[model samples]
Target: MRHGRSPWMIRLIVLVLRPLLMVVTRRDWQGAANLPEGGFVLAPNHLSHVDPILISHFMVDHGITPRFLAKDTIMRARGVGWVLRKAAQIPVYRSTDGATDSMRAAVQAVRDGEVVTIYPEGTITRDPDVWPMSGKTGAVRVALAAGMPLVPVMQWGPQEILWPYSKRLRLLPRRTIHVRVGDPVDLDDLHGKELTEPLLREATDRLMDALTAMMAEVRGELPSGERIDIHTLAKPRTTYKPKEI
Candidate 1:
């Protein structure tokens, strides 16, 4: 299960996507030195639907082929599903018993020396200012279970190209995407500890705090220090439309 050469399908996708990403976005990627040589969990803030492509571009350019924990619906699609399977992406069956299975697969992937990218926020930001909200415990759980490094990667500017849940693409401006990779989160003290709900929540908060701070450095604006909880919102998490400022 160790990481090997990229499959043909993944290579083809890189060929097609790398050029398009370069054309549409300028890169301000930093902290490649922070990436570990072996397996690790990549925890990034979820901004827009286009985040996977943008983050994958950064990982691939730096010689790491990231395996995402994608939704099962995407994994069940006709053409794209086939590619994801071939590329060894993990599928998440949300709200079902199979959800735990997805976490197991992700932990195994990390243990087997593959980079697994999980969006800790679980979905696009529900915050009106597009700041990262509170995170789910899945990413921290996977990293702790596998005993691997948990790297916090913050990305800004994808929302400028494509607003959250929007179908329209803003390709005219050629935005510059800012990506900053932080040092592996220090969980050495909690590595062998039991995966209790309180412990997991604490770790998730640390990861989110690191992400928000890195994001502030990228955007040069301070966050409000309060994270929005999707569960508290009246509107449905996935169906709520983005309000214009």
Candidate 2:
């Protein structure tokens, strides 16, 4: 797979953030060999807001530039939006007519040999114990549409630096972030099948199961129960305030 040059903005951002990340966190990254050549979908579990930074650090070190599917609100933010655009990230207009447009753009990016990182959980996990929760169908749809490998990249320890929904950062004690990239999910059997709701749900379950299992390996324990489905909660966990378990 041929590599295209990264935008100047991406280089500059990496030049600045890479050093800071190296200082603030130690990495226990593995499975670099599992990253396939050329373009593919990278699906990682969402733990904290800082996940993208740490995950990007890993991908960059392995010579892959990751394009994230960011929320449209962030894409429209004054300073941040400009940076994201300049860095060549894709914007996702959630719950809008433009959502389909965003997915098409992502699939094109993969076909063009760009690694697109999609957080399967869509948002930070609402699981009280910080385990990966159930996922949405976006990642599966993209991988299926593009006919590309869907790789599961599981991570832990970003929450130690910044807990979910918390505004504080704990940087004194440098944390060790653990990331493992699993082999591409086996979807060959379902590739030519119709993209039905049941088919999508099955693919998503396989993706989430792979992620949760890899996470269990990193955390040294299995999840206490079934993966938490955020939609089933009594109250939507949407605020920045840390929720009580």
Candidate 3:
């Protein structure tokens, strides 16, 4: 467990951004008590690019340091890369480190007692309604591999700040970011079973369903039975796609 500059960097951001966000974004956080004291998975629906920062504020406030698995190419950027590296964020090597390599890193992060946040969909949801779409199996592998709980956390209103797949940033009116942290998804039965394809799909589906339900609760509406499956619906490729080494 290499302790990078995450300690000070997280505190620094929270010290500054927390207050600013308080004034700019109203918060509705529930089920925070469900967050375990040790290592765990903080899986959330992908709504905006700024979700990591927003959710970081939420988890950090609850004393959980978030470790996100990002793309390796994004780590080569001029400034953002530096911050990610400094904060010890995991970079998924889509074509280099192998498929399960990032999983290894994430498992290690969870074992190290840091909350690892994964977008089960692997990318932002393609659902036109901004609801939680489909999910991948990465989160399931990490949680089961590390023997940690997979906590479903959902957030709304970040789209109000920065709409998904859009460049326009609406920050004047101070939108309310509604984040609801729900109980950990029950993976005991699936975890004990063989890590098969059908089992993985079932596990990931349960995870996304939990998140989608939470989002519906936050919105006070019912979600559609059909959710967008990113792997098939719209392949929003990342900078570098991780492949098996």
Residues 146-175, candidate 2, lDDT per residue (tens digit)?
Answer: 999999999998988888988987876889
Put down candidate 1 lDDT per residue, 210-238, tens digits, no spaces: 99999999888987758997557665555
Q: Using Cα atoms with residue i matched to residue i, what is each candidate's TM-score against the true structure?
A: 0.93, 0.94, 0.90
- Stretches of candidate 3 above 4 Å error? 1-6, 235-245
lDDT, model 2: 0.89
| lDDT of model 2 at position 123 | 87
Q: Rate the local accuracy (lDDT) of all candidates.
A: 0.89, 0.89, 0.80
CA shift at 217, candidate 3, in angstroms? Answer: 1.4
Backbone clashes (count) for model 2: 0
TM-score for model 3? 0.90
Span of 10 residues, lowest total lDDT, candidate 3: 236-245
- Which candidate model has the greater lDDT, 2 or 3? 2
Q: How many Å off is the CA of 36 in candidate 1?
A: 0.5
- Put the candidates in lDDT order, highest first: 2, 1, 3
